[model samples]
Target: MGPTLDSSYEDWVRVAEGVVPPGRHRVGGREEDGAGAVFAVVSPRDGSTLASVADAGEKEVDLAVAAARWAFDSGPWPRLAPAERGRVLLRIADLVEEHRSEIAALISLENGKPIAESYGIELRAVAGTFRWYGQLADKVCDEAPHTDPGALALVTREPAGVVGAVVPWNFPLTLAAWKIAPALAAGCAVVLKPSELTPLSALLLGRLVDEAMEEAGVPGGVLNVVAGDGPTAGRALGLHPDVDVLAFTGSTAVGRHYLRYSADSNLKRVWLELGGKSPNIVLPDAPDLDAAAATAAWGIFFNQGEMCTAPSRLLVHSSVAERVTDAVIQRAEALRVGDPLDPATEMGALAGAARLDAVRGHIDAARAAGARLRTGGAPLDPAPVPGGTYLRPTVFDRVTPDMAVAREEIFGPVLSVLTFDTVEEAVALANDTEYGLAAGLWTGDLSTAHTVSRALRAGTVWVNCYEEGDLTVPFGGYKQSGNGRDKSAHALEKYTELKTTWIQL
Candidate 1:
């Protein structure tokens, strides 16, 4: 009925173990030793250490930045013809597809997403992103506005030089691909710093980049990856004077830090795709109330609810609130939560122990504030392995706009249901959040869909659907959700600088 697994869990597990080694960094196209400090790559499925990776620091960041600078200034990547570069990226895409099973397994272990989702969604996005950007590499056209015959004007674009891409633990490889593919397509060198919690997938991706580059007969050092926590290595990258631009996908707080980092250092262009408390509204006139409720449940519970654009806030029309909320609660409770490696699991563990506790704390705060605990709110046992953390899908009804659960991004499998009586109230409630990444509404009325969608302040609006998008459409947000698009041809703007030349006739 859905996307089937390419292989069994045991088969993927066997492939994951051999994907990459511990304490490795890919710098200047070579595997190099990280300084002595190290951190454990703890699997959220089980607290056991999958590998001990280098606890990257200032030294590692400096080395990676230097390598990227060199590559940008005097390497084959930036000098290659756009088509030639696209060929390399196509090779990378092919390689990714070839090793899809391995990367999927790695992501499931490092990030606690189900193996099926990892294979079907994350890895698929990664390969497709590279392929899309690759095909578009030579397709971008520079512009020159028409002028009088006395003057000749020309406009051109150049790579922005070194880019520092810092990604968080959730959807590690997928987010990395979003930044790397476009930056590379624009001929910009990159230094990637992956979150400490889930660095293995990114590390493996760096190796794959090198693999593709080697086959294309191109020089290395175009892309470098370093693994570490946010403060040490991430800050170093942010403050590095050599980085020409930085692209980050994480929390709004961290996005603010990167802004400050740019201001304090080179004043590099910083493009951020930050947090979201996206709202999914269900109107009384929805074409299919059943589908809307099911999608609402899926949106909040998918990926253990770690998505930036997760529909955490559910706004329903008063006329059908009870029926829709009950349907969603049923779906949430019925979701299969267990080992991430299981092919049949619909939900999986949180990142680790700390994440589990943080989610619990959010639930407790919601309870303290007097929100109704509708269906699921508790943590399941350490399953499949000791120390594994799985939280049951949680739903909070009768939630007020002022409540913590409704206002904050819990980043867990928690949904807050709020109600609206009229179109004006629904519009106000949806646009009330500080983060405007995405929003969805379900209705059958043509005018209502058009008018309401036009009124919503979110970057992407889906009518009668949720989280459905292709690579052609861009994704980003309005106000606090951060700046710039992550997909489509516009993403290249983040990695390139525009230059104008004017000559007298």
Candidate 2:
């Protein structure tokens, strides 16, 4: 008999928790590895063990890389007609749509995000990314200069060979698709290493790709997945000479390590999307203090402030600082921090216990350095649920630009509010961080928006909102936030190489 589908999330949860087995990886047309003599996959929500996965050490990384390289060089995928590739990718996107509920549930379970939000937003965004890249597959154009009269020049774009995509934990499936779709669209094979905290969804994606490609006529070994610790599996992939490109999303310190590895091993293409300490500036001319406060609260606390481009620093004009701070505190305190599986839950746990500790340490340090706490100092007691990495939303007032809490990227639900007297001071404070991933400006004045948009060093600036993005726009960071762009047609450039051909007759 065929497997019966579970309609509701509650039924799915019961099945996923071992009444029915969560699926396994599809490596070369078979369900090869599930939980046989390997690493444990535990739930951050209740700390209960989920499944043990393959250890996937250097040996497995090598095998995955080999499979990817074979697919890139000798397999029919890279050599397939561009329209054919595009169509297959579109089929993959359709498969994503078909499995949307299952995929979203896996994401929420693995990443500790609210289920409704994951299903309602994140999954749709991921599908949009795949569809966008699928459309982009055949649209990439190469141009020739018309400088020489007697000489002919031709240009073409080709895949970057095997790509090592190392994605972070925060937005597991979305970020993975950010790297994978473009690379696949550009005809490059991928060996992806998802963060240990949230590998389940990525593994599920591997399964989906296998089924989709089989239906769409994509060759075997075109994509591979291996989940393990960053230092071991991730570093090895970066340092592997055969891997032509490494696209990483993580912390600054780790990015530097990958850069060193890439440089030392093969001088391979290394693209990183690193840390952020984005500023949300509220000018004195802002009309609605309530709207600004609410938006700013979402800016800092959304996804428990685990976003790479989250606006962690609130640079408020002196005139409205007190009002904004008070309003923001009210909103922060009102956030429903509880089980991510609960439909009423607005904010969920930190990625894990270690992250909860890190959030606490940063809060304690800020306190020791004399920053005033506005709300939420410690983890919620009696606990929101059973075993998730739970922490209440935290807000720190009187934060100076130089303070560690203000300057550093604390990937948590911590907001640092600082007052600025003048527009110039506000601009300075906003650009004070080494990260330039994103910034938000709230002002009634058009002049201020244009001025600050030009002046602020972030790659993405929101005039009245935060975390807003579409597939048509580009996303990347300036300074240490890392290089190269993601999303839009530009993202394909990272995965494909340009070649110039000269002919004279």
Candidate 3:
């Protein structure tokens, strides 16, 4: 059992002040001063100031990058045996688990995710990710090829040096783990820039890392964290010539900027897990309409629809479109949207006022474009959760493929409903999006499931379930959705460079 958290704003402020001290930046295993520019971290839960911390700019970013580079070039991290590194990572994972309750509380207070989800899904995944990569550290091996009698050839993978990771606000700690754990396991030093919107958890993670590394005898400067916005700190890390790799998870627009930065600078490898407007297709042969409707609502409304792989666009066969749409509306309306800390709440506030406004704009645009509003279309009254940025789940029926609401990534609990007459049409509709991170299909026929899954351009295809999988499966996107996979053994490829050695006697 873990310590109980007080969800009141005053109590949260007290906790946050202690967890994230002022002028926080972890460099070389020590708390360092960041650039004098401080940013107020506002809680989307009740629009209150949680705390203020120094924001990293170019100067601070330079310090962080230099620390990471020094750690890689002259420090003991890369020189350590693979098994030793694995042991250190395992220790870090244990520390994360020990602090699970506090982490979940911070996420709920800062990022506006439900406390239950922050614990059950986000924090649990963060610890599991570290454990998974920790176990994989010693398993990575070199290969020897059978060659000519006079020659010997060996292929090996080596760390890519300093890795600059820029993570987003949604599931901040979990996404950071996706990049940081793998990079560390591959023997790379890291300079992580967590999103300014929610830096508390990542800052707390830095503290945990410092303690774990100290306990495990891992050297200082192996991991540095910089908290700031994209323009200054993120760009500095991206363009730093000494930084050998950049791993980013955010919007596609920002992902493209990293590519340009890579081209303009050292041409370091960039791995991106970007935006998605994923489709959820419901066929006439769907196993069960009730189950499908429930899954659809959960898919979009979960995390307040801020997930990159959210099933925002729902496609149904004409025969069952009305039935499925009605059922989905019923499910959405039944969801409890209130204070995130409340255990009974199914959904919570948006990350900020900007997100709430963006969702409302999308709803208005859809209505003007002649789409039928089947359910919620406005922000919830502040009476339930005063000052919180809350919105009721919205469903737009009779939405065309060409509508703005259907085409854009709204990043809210807004569902766009479209109908298809045949399997071919469904496939076409699902493939029409510029983003292809993920897609889902509900069908009883195995052939239809297999055929449609293969036809979809998404990186992940869910046949009967939505957002299903574990750490073993690869997650990424195709086309404009971005490049490079995150999770599973496939993720290790991005953090290392391959080299071939030949010997002739």
Candidate 4:
């Protein structure tokens, strides 16, 4: 079922409230909030209020976990045939696709991305994640290990019960699917804590799950969502002893805190996909300067660079540094910043005002630390829509490796360009940062491509393309970018635990 079209702001508001329904927390198959009072969900695009949800404290967390534990232990979900689960997942995917526009609109309003691109493209990706994992639910398996003749042994895979998924504001729906699809496919109940800045989509997802599960016969209490701040709802999920697994996608600093929090409990499995100061290297002999320049623009500017894989660090070989930087600046200038609902709008605002402040502070610091701002050094005026949190894409030239702009994850449409004389220097500079989420290399030389690809210590490397991959490839990071992989058949492993059984013959 696709999303029903809404004509006005009132209609959109109606859709928003209908998605989650004005409610407390859905605990133990009932509507109620635990401790904290009601809080509002605001739209970043225009500062319009979306929904007010119960803050949901520890009591609610306990109730949600207990319900999930009950569902996993006594409900049909865990015991149901794998094909049955697969069918339900397929149904969810269909419903998601049907409601794509409504879902995308809600996401754009709350998270502040262009509605057309986000809803049209990203939402489809969101739905497909479930469809992709649904087909693989039955394919997950474990093999018997070779053992001594005196012993008979077998290895089995089982779902880690009660997952605590903490998702960030950027790409809320898509990233939420990254955690939800795999865990559900593996037969685990989820208590998702979406970022406070963009909780509408998460709440809507709860409604979608309800509809999908009911149609597919998934029992109640299998999937729950609690909307609140990280310290309260997020901490409760990560630190909950009953939650068997904790999966998160956010910043490196927060990921570390979750790691420490989870360790205090049953040592529940922790899977994190964290930050990146990923490099997009332009080699001296890049095949197509024009194409590479355009891709480089998209790499850092797409979603207004509110992406973990945003290639914020542009390492250009001295030969093409001037040409590439000029082209990138030109493209950044032409981008239209306005209402996200417009199909022609290429760039959306930063996710929220707080994010805008953070980006502004980073740019100011870079300037104070002696970097040259080539263009777009500040936020744009409120567009015709008014109250929108927009920023002109900023670029800095002559950025040194030691500069904070070059080293840190700005998580904005701020590009820092640095120059290097040789291949060795380029590779060294590209790998200088603490992050290893993704890196892009543009080179006409086959040997250079192969060598640089291997040398860069990142999880995913794009040879000539940037951000081009389907759900099949594995994605994660190295060094401080955090551990565990997302997408492909490997993600299921994170949600499932391996058990070894032995019998004396």
Best by lDDT: 1
lDDT of 3 by residue, 1-505 (tens): 3544434545444544455433488988888876567898888989988888778989999998888888899988998888888888888889888988778878888899887788778988999998999999999889999999899999999998999999999899999999999999999999999999998889889889888888877767888998899998899999999999999999999999999999999999999899999999999899998899999999999999999999999999999998999999999989999887775678999999998988899899999999999999888875356888999999999899999999999999999999999999999999998999999999999988999999999999998899989999999999889999999999999999999999995
- Candidate 2 residue runs with Cα over 4 Å from true position: 1-26, 29-37
Return model 4's CA RMSD, one decimal.
2.5
Over 4 Å off in model 4, which ranges?
Answer: 1-24, 28-30, 146-151, 382-384
Off by over 4 Å in 3: 4-23
- What TM-score number comes out for model 2? 0.95
Clashing pairs in 3: none
Cα misplacement distance, residue 3 of candidate 2 (Å): 17
Candidate 1, residue 426: the lDDT equals 96
Clashing pairs in 1: none
What's each prediction's TM-score? Answer: 0.98, 0.95, 0.97, 0.95
Tens digits of per-residue lDDT, candidate 1, 17-97, equal 666644589998998777878788888888878888877889988999999988889888898999999999999998888
| lDDT tens digits, residue span 389-446, model 4 | 8889899998899999999999999999999999899889988889999999999999
Model 4 residue pairs with clashes:
1-98, 2-98, 2-99, 3-98, 3-99, 25-32
Clashes per prediction?
0, 2, 0, 6
Q: Looking at candidate 4, what is the lDDT of residue 263?
A: 79
